[model samples]
Target: MSTTTSPSKHLLELQGVHTHIGAYHILHGVDLVVPRGELTLLLGRNGAGKTTTLRTIMGLWQASQGSLRFDGRDISRLHTPQIAGLNIAYVPENMGIFADLTVKENMLLAARQARTVAQIDEARLQWIFGLFPAVQKFWNHPAGKLSGGQKQMLAVSRAIVEPRQLLIIDEPSKGLAPVMINNMIDAFAQLKASGVTILLVEQNIHFAKRLGDSVAVMDNGRVVHAGRMAELAADEALQRSLLGLAL
Candidate 1:
């Protein structure tokens, strides 16, 4: 495990977050922080409540207790659009792309909402095309015509069009072919290098192992383990116990 410093340098802080989904209580005083300019992975088995945590951070679900702060501002009571206006982009597991829209059309719409997006628009499209060349090859193609992995890439690329301060992505690799999965990892690494703060929720341990810088493991709605991704990879016991993987 890597050595720890204090969390005072964090850009996003969630202190003792308590959230409920419908009648079900999910988060039990959850605490998390996303340091500025760093990639953080949220990992766990199914039903561990990682999705809810992301929603809470995005203000989709308000915490019954605790506070969420972004860049030293209290946002626990902010609306979803308010948080989004702050440049925190979220790509849900569904990819959320309009299937009928073409890649060019999607980028066009995104560009209209964000003017500075031009830089990211130029950089992100080029980078994504490089990461998954299929995108460039199919620029005018409708999103619905693409495969699962291609759709996933488009979703991420769509989010990156605006160059947000933070990106929270859920299950970017769900139902993807092995080749596409590898390609996605490379793309994520490129985004990190380009200065994107990422909070990713992933179930595929191998994918997380390849892309994650730091890993936080959640179980039963609470974080139970956190450390450098290297440490998580080396500890077979931790993997088997926390993730039920046959390490």
Candidate 2:
């Protein structure tokens, strides 16, 4: 019999997942679900295993126990490149841009099918430029010269250089000014509207509340809360209990 589950609403699901990094346990039975075509927010305090969960999903860290399912297929044993080949894009917290490369070079590298700038899909490139003008403005400039927020935009732009089934991002708004955060929020909103499932590890409650359709809160290496983002946003007590602060 096949190990893969039947099709369901969730694009990604982690059940009883446990991960260890060289004798140190990071995730303890973390259960998370990213519903198809919705933005899911993974929220928690520091050292709450959020990053570990993302890494495990990407196969950067192996799971000691349990299963990871993506699109009804078991991906628990897949390699990182194999996982990425399934049209899932991951943008790490550090933004993962090549500082030495020009902005255009960074984007070209992400487009697996394109060998040159002229080969890249013009419409898609234009759409990305619309989402982040700085990308176009600094196309010839080295990625290292861009501002923090610009770099974050470039990272996300690179992730969507080609179409993707899911986008996994870690803290897109971290260290961004309020104006840049708002811009990022708007870009994400458009991305969501265009029908891409997103699983984001976010520290900004306001950003989470605004963009998240589903929310999962991790605590002590496990999911303590899972439900609609509106419910979590409206409940101050629950917010305090799960996140230690009001949203």
Candidate 3:
């Protein structure tokens, strides 16, 4: 098993974050760090506040307490658009695709600075196509016609339509077949190779074990464990104790 004291550099950091949805409190003093150029996995059982933490980071839900920092700048109170403008991309579990639109149109919509496909960087589009062949195959087709896995690919493609510093994705492998999950894992590996920081909320142990550089496990709205993924994967007892299953 491998271990480290801490990351050398953090691209994103959350300190004591708390969230409230109406009268109910969700997150409580949640602390997480996404190291530069590394994939950080956020894992927990159902209703563990994993999704709420992601939403809070994206400004979809306002944090009632604590500080959020991206690249050394404070962003605790920023709205969604302003936060997105900082070159961070988020893909929720729903995949957030426009069902009525063509895949090409959907990509165009995510490219905020581009009005047409021609305006998007050709090399970047080619790279995205390489990462997700399904996206390229269904480029001109209505998003609604694609299967669940295909829609997830389109969602990730849209998130990377423009170059981004950080990619925050929720459950990329959720409900996918083994083959589809492998494809998603490969795509994420390539994205990591390109040096984009990533924070992922994932339940699939295989997916997380294969791709995660660092891990944070949450329970009842707070982080309970933080360490190298390799260490967690190597220790079955730790896995069972924290995740209730061995990887």
Candidate that would win on lDDT: 2
Error of 2 at 104 (Å): 0.4
**Best-fitting candidate, scored by TM-score:** 2
Model 1 score (lDDT): 0.83
Pairs of residues clashing in candidate 3: none
Q: Candidates 2 and 3: which is better by lDDT?
A: 2
Q: Model 2: per-residue lDDT, tens digit, 1-247?
A: 6696567999999999999999899899999999999999999999999999999999999999999999999999999999999999999999999999999999999999999999999999999999999999999999999999999999999999999999999999999999999999999999999999999999987799899999999999999999999999999999998888998
- Single out the weakest 10-residue window by summed lDDT for candidate 2: 1-10
TM-score, candidate number 2: 0.97
Q: How high a TM-score does candidate 1 get?
A: 0.90
- For candidate 2, the lDDT comes to 0.96
Please identify which of the two predictions, 1 or 2, would achieve the higher lDDT against the true structure: 2
Q: Model 1, 1-247: lDDT tens per residue? A: 8997654567888888999878999999888878777788998888899999999998899999999899888999999989988988889988888889897676666654554434445665676678778767778899899998888888887787767889999999899988889888888888888888889998777788887887788999888887888888988887889888843
Q: Rate the local accuracy (lDDT) of all candidates.
A: 0.83, 0.96, 0.95
